[model samples]
Target chain A: MSSPATQPDFGSARPGGRTARTRAAVRDATLAELAAHGYRGLTVDGVAERSGVHRTTVYRRWGGVDGLVVDALDLAGEDGWQPPDTGGFAGDCRALAAEVHRSFADPAQGAASAAVVAASFQSPRAAEALRGFYADRNARSEVIVSRAVDRGELPAGTDAAAVVRAVVAPLFHRLFITREPLDAGVAEQAAEAAVAAALAGVFQLPSGA
Target chain B: MSSPATQPDFGSARPGGRTARTRAAVRDATLAELAAHGYRGLTVDGVAERSGVHRTTVYRRWGGVDGLVVDALDLAGEDGWQPPDTGGFAGDCRALAAEVHRSFADPAQGAASAAVVAASFQSPRAAEALRGFYADRNARSEVIVSRAVDRGELPAGTDAAAVVRAVVAPLFHRLFITREPLDAGVAEQAAEAAVAAALAGVFQLPSGA
Candidate 1:
């Protein structure tokens, strides 16, 4: 997986062409198949059939199911989506938490995410893809924490990725571990807890360590 | 899935007998198969052969792979394992974090856990089993927080389960999400952050909530 601090520019818009459209269609199909069948059950033929793309085209272009799945994850966040920045760090954290809650609480999108998470545990390649997806997402999200630090709301040298992870960890724990209901209260508390932790410098790394 | 607060008595020990021996063998085989082939690839026949137990016996006792998997998870923590408690709440939290880190970073145990987590996302039955396992584990560990509260370290209304979840959430996020290295520093930080949040009353529910 790519380092969280040094990620390649992911999800760049493709030039308008037949290839771009076909790729978009294939990404949709891959996500659908993943949600319906999970990573273990998904196959190239199934995706090609569902996408209405030729099997040969999928096999040649994407190489295999792993590539397609990676692309699917990419498509979900590659629209240059930035983390929420609502001026104050607390508000920004709340907005980011709300966004994560919405995505995981949405049935279709949640299923797709659960499928990818399950698949990652089984396959190393899938794990790498998931890691890269998060790395890229966090890379984009660091700005929120950076801005907070610049405003003197947080201590210098605070790890932005740690802060973001702290905000979202409880939500994921409830979603994937406890399988609990994720409502507005949970999201608000998650953001609040992260803010509290960050303010205490819990996310700070040892200097020069 | 069982509610986190109310879980069935998990991992109760059986008396010395042929049944106990058979069950133990089956549990071992189930973990091996789960680690080797994952939940998706696990099969009754594979388990029966691996355990050298008759296929009929395996089928009659376990019902199916999910049952065996649940039973396997049960055996892992059935030894009445308790979270570490070194007087202070911070020490107890640190011990709990260390325990979680050791389990997840251990190759064989981690792979088995990964398999169960992966499988749970794919199958509803598996999800139920995984939820039950965590519910039982957390139910057992809640005493740590209760002790702290009684010691006047935390407010009386601190949510014990929430505190425990906070202690382990970031570790799981790393274990299952960003796929970062699970080192001593990370574990120490996870415990420290959870302690900080709990002290700040982040885990407290609203009055009457």
Candidate 2:
């Protein structure tokens, strides 16, 4: 493992501060545990042990496994999350789809995601964390739509977050419910379908009905 | 509980007969167990006791808990499974979406469905059963697209099953992944967006692409 001295801190008060380093270590340990054992088997002790933090510190800081998982999820959401702005709606949608597909299709990330989804079913807090995580993700991607509107590729009142959700939701269905084959083609289909539907005002909430 | 005699069999041979009665009892008991205890907590002995079938009979017929759940799923899929023929693609899509929403949104049915989905994650046989159930459902709904094709609303050679999958996928995402509140409005949005995407050739798999 690389030493903390070599690691870059994006814009922290102290580049190699003990608190930030400890937080990073704990989050990494949480993800590792989630990927290895799934949420059902995850434990605070395991995370504390793997993170090399005191058990009391772990318990005092996170309070429980759900808290730790939520923190890990927040960290995951923040890192490398900006969707590519390919200048148009279709390109942006496709880029975002591809990025999401790759993340969810990778073995480690896939397992971590599945673990989180499974945990959400058993706990209301996990469910809320998942919703918050996706909401943030969708919000970050809304720039794609704003750019599309500026370029006159879509109408002024298109729901950008809905468009992003539409593009990603099918893949989530396949991964979590249908368990279907997910490939580049699937990503392309999701992007194209969302683009088509958004252009047609299908995602725009109707005035009355 | 009503007598088995009161339940119609929809023209099955030996309806209300002893064997049919036993099967119905077992399946209903299985659903109750699933709803009460979830997939991991389900047991063959528990089902046998609740179903009033002999332990040997339950063991001999279903082989185990997973087998019992699969058989229960088959029974669930077969009963009252038809979507309304609303005479046009959009109407048919909306009706089918509403039906799915109702079934999935009902408390008992929803809990039972969640148990099975959870089981699928841990058992290959359960996964196969889920895939088979959905394949049959998609086949049943293909007529909607076929009629649309006949009416020249959708292009000829549209993949009927793909359209159906697209239409229903967002709801599944909400039910299983996003854990979002699913209302009629959400159902309507899913159906309308799918219809719009289908018309734009988004769901059509390109030749050699």
Candidate 2 per-residue lDDT, tens place, B25-117, comes to: 888788788778877778988898998899899999889988887886676556554555788899988877777787676676667777777
Q: Where is model 2 more than 4 Å wrong at Cα?
A: A1-16, A207-209, B1-16
Tell me the tens digit of each residue's lDDT in model 2 across A86-198.
77789988877787777666676566667777777666787787777776767777888889888988888787767877888888877767677899888888889899999
Q: What are the per-model C-alpha RMSD values against the true structure?
A: 4.6, 5.8
Q: Per-residue lDDT of B1-209 in model 1, one digit per residue for the tens?
A: 11112222222444478888789888777877888998778999999999999999999988998888777766655655566769999998988888777766667666777777777876788788778778878878899888998999998878888888888888888877778888878888888888998899998866713
DockQ metric for all predictions: 0.68, 0.61
**Residue-pair clashes per candidate, as listed?**
0, 0
Highest-scoring model, lDDT: 1
Model 1 chain A scores worst on lDDT over the 10 consecutive residues at A1-10
Among residues 3 or more apart in sequence or in different chains, the pairs in candidate 2 whose N, CA or C atoms overlap within 3 Å are none
Candidates in order, TM-scores: namely 0.90, 0.86
Candidate 1 ranges beyond 4 A from true positions: A1-15, B1-15
Candidate 1 per-residue lDDT, tens place, A1-209, comes to 11112222222334468987899888878878888887777899999999999999999999998898777766655565677767899998888888777776667666777677777876788888889888778778888899999999999989988888888888888887778778978888888888888899988877812
